[model samples]
Target chain A: MIEEFFLRALIAGVGVAAVAGPLGCFVVWRRMAYFGATLAHGALLGIALGLLIDVDPVFGIAASSVLIALIVTGLQRQGAIGGDTLLGILAHAGLALGLVALAFMSVRIDLMAYLFGDVLAVTWSDILWIYLGGTAVLATLALIWNTLLAITLNEELARAEGIDTARIQLVFMLILAVVIAIAMKIVGVLLIVSLLIIPAAAARPFARTPEQMAALAAAAGALSAAAGLFASLQWDTPAGPSIVAAATAIFALSFTFSGTLGKRAA
Target chain B: MALDKRSAGTGLLVEAKGLTVRFGASSALDGVDLTVSSGEIVSLIGPNGAGKTTLVRAVAGLVEASAGTLWRQPDLRIGYVPQRLSIDRVMPLTVRRLLSLAGRSSGAEIVSALAEVDAAALLKHAIHDLSGGEFQRVMLARALLRKPHLLLLDEPLQGVDLGGQLALYDLIGRLRRRHAMGVLLVSHDLHIVMAATDRVVCLNHHVCCSGAPESVRHHPEYTALFGAEAARRLAVYTHAHDHAHDLAGNPVAAADTNHADNEPEHLS
Candidate 1:
């Protein structure tokens, strides 16, 4: 039973790493850390909608995250308010609304399972969705990788070269929504932001290029996921938090090592 | 891939029609009309708040023009090197990698672009380790690597040393002659503007003057836009000899002030 649990977690962890690698690179590159959180929080609303409508929660999550992404993009373009202020309002509102909606559900649901993922409870079907969603996200990201990196480096420069930033941004956000929705199962909504950030941040100091950054981040994410799963198994801790904790540990170690290297070079 | 369409037979790489830009209440650029013909290098100059950057950003489409349109030749590819190239140092990147990030380019192309700005040797160096001049050259190399039909540069000489500035100027000269690419440069270097640019556009929230650099200097509108004192200061900033110490015998505290003093005012 323990071996089976470990194997299941490993499959799910790979799915998360595959999506997080490239998406996380963008998160760090575009300085979209808060934006990543916004999308993650918005996933809760997706969950609530899914449960309320008797549909798959992942579908609901993708839809809700996409909607939130669109809202943020629209407000930013329209200059309704500054991005951070608007994000602050939306982030909390989404969380509050999700909680409120969850409370109104007629049947009691294990809300903690969604917030802090129960990786062990992931069925074979859930594993299929994870792989399918993760593959689609990675393929799409690879196709537009150069263009996306160019835009992230400098928006106007990209535009001048006939790279449609608006179109590219829409595609990027859509992919991010899908990734967030699917990965929410492995890491949970609350901690999904960590998977997107910590691995990427950890890989940043060592990367020579954007490609290297994404590759290293993916490796770091997968390693952390494995390490976290083993630690959680030994200690009987919750899966999602344990994964994030392990990722944080990796980040701490990388930060210290990279810092020392930087000082030595200086 | 659709060809970039521009106005027919204009020979101008970029044309701005009644371009106006505002930041809140005050107009940063007002009714500015300018043109940069193929192979022509146009330099924009003005006082501190004279809307030099505003005009350039408007042209680059970095900032939307409150009113007016900017058109470029259908095939014109613009490369914009912004004034502030400094990002968070924690952001790890290398010069060669940054250039390739623009688009896929051959190693030879990358080498040539770097060679143009004399940054070829530092290709593998991390961005954080690069000097101000070297950093700017990397940006230039990135821009050139794209083989743009038009290059829009904002304060390219801002942090560069005299040698770097001259080297970049030479590269710009080569680009203009070899590729017939139009160059739109915004600089406070008044001395080089007259010599470097085929055309000079004097701007102070409007088209103060636009013509040959020497001719623009003689225009009363140009003098009136800056007034006598400011015009003199701009003249001083432009001239190499005028970089002498200020009233207190200290070097003029300007963006171009070199690192010889090793002051804490590291521009980055």
Candidate 2:
């Protein structure tokens, strides 16, 4: 009953959302929303450079995000400057440099498509990349899940218990970078962090444990993807923003159930 | 390695000889030699800028030593209760979930660990909602879940009421006896600390004095560093030891060489 292009878009969007849900919880837990924003901004530069070099944009995005992650980690270790200020600076610079590079590129590219995402234009190859790359990301995340949770809870505590915290942190950043590389096609640069965090926040009101929160976040994100896709079709709206809007709506709606988890939070 | 007083079997869990840790140019811990053997409670006491926390971290292998030899028993399992471990509100966590972080712990094991800390009912309670004393009990439960050979507790009594501190210290004493574990306690409170400590190492960037709890109180370096008033207040929990106070005189002389400029600054 559905056209193939619409079906492809649904599959791709839902796939990205499922992966984003678990990783997004870490983003929220670690209070790294600005860090996520910084990585997405750096991802834009990756896309521009990829087109310039005539290589796969996924590779460029991964490289750029990972490089930004390393720089942030290094700066945190030095810890001489304010962390949020440094992140704000890097985020703006990455965005400005990316825009300048995109303006100078010779190839004809739709700036709006990369800025807000063009989910309807995704091809079979893009869907393939989403599933394959996302599988690798999720598996790696599972491998480091407990240690990552430990570090997120307390880095010093993890190190005290014989965990190699620095290596675990670098590995977590790499996973975040890979997620950015794949999910960039679905939510685009500007609203990518919303896709990563909103669903996790929505699930928090119901979850009583970390694993439950992660599983609930994935389900919430998937439901949001499906709902946002249909809403876009009905209203003839931009697909990416529609998905983010749907997620925000769910996040807002979840407050009604706040007492479920909130009553015990004090 | 030569500082290792005994093998792992005999429970010389961690030993440091002339260990020095530097942050840039300033020395946090200088020429520190400390050791903890089985069934021993060694309390590290110092002022605000003292490297007490740093020494605990170093023994737990968190910080790299710049100089001197630091050795731990091979395959040493450590249970470390950090000074500050406030679980963020954003995290949805129960006491049960917190203990499970120690890996492979079961429901029965979790319950028992909580029972060991006198907080058996907190197993299902949300960690964020726990009172300061309750949160500490839960953290101790988590650490106990590791079944560690060495327990490193950094300021375990912070934010706790004095009555609650005595209770907590009692719980720690029972756990140590039952598990035969070595305890490395870092604390700033003198009144309650001397009551619980078997040995006290007064530290201020270096080892000022170390001996039986009562003996170290009268040492010149200890009195000079913490102020004589602190030493007098610490005498509140006096207990007779086999060795007399003057037995610590030799280490006091050695320790004074590094901080000769620091005279006894009596409390005003």
Which residue segments of model 2 deviate by more than 4 Å? Answer: A259-266, B1-10, B194-196, B215-268
lDDT of candidate 1 over A149-215, digit per residue (tens)? 7787777778767788888888888888888877777888888888988998889878877788888
lDDT of 2 by residue, A1-266 (tens): 88998999899999999999999999999999999999999888988899899899888888888888878878978998789988998888988899999999987799888888888989999999899988998999999998889889998988777788879878878888888877777878998999889999999888889888888899889988889999999999889999999999999889765765446534
DockQ of each: 0.43, 0.72
Clashing pairs in 2: none
TM-score of chain B of 1: 0.73
Query: Interface RMSD (C-alpha) of each candidate?
Result: 2.5, 1.3
User: Model 2, residue B190: displacement in angstroms?
Assistant: 2.7
Q: Model 1: how far is A155 from its true place, Å?
A: 0.8
Query: Over the stretch B1-268, how does candidate 1's per-residue lDDT look in tens digits?
Result: 1223333232877888998888888788777899888778888875567788877777776788888888766756777897776755545678877877867787778887787777789989988788777887788778777777778888887877755665566667776676677888887553336245777775657665466544334545545764553333232112222233343323343445442222233211
Query: What TM-score does structure 2 among the candidates reach?
Result: 0.87
Give the share of true interchain contacts found in each model. Answer: 0.54, 0.85
Candidate 1's displacement at residue B181, Å, is 2.9
Error of 2 at B187 (Å): 2.2
lDDT of each: 0.76, 0.81
Error of 1 at A198 (Å): 0.7
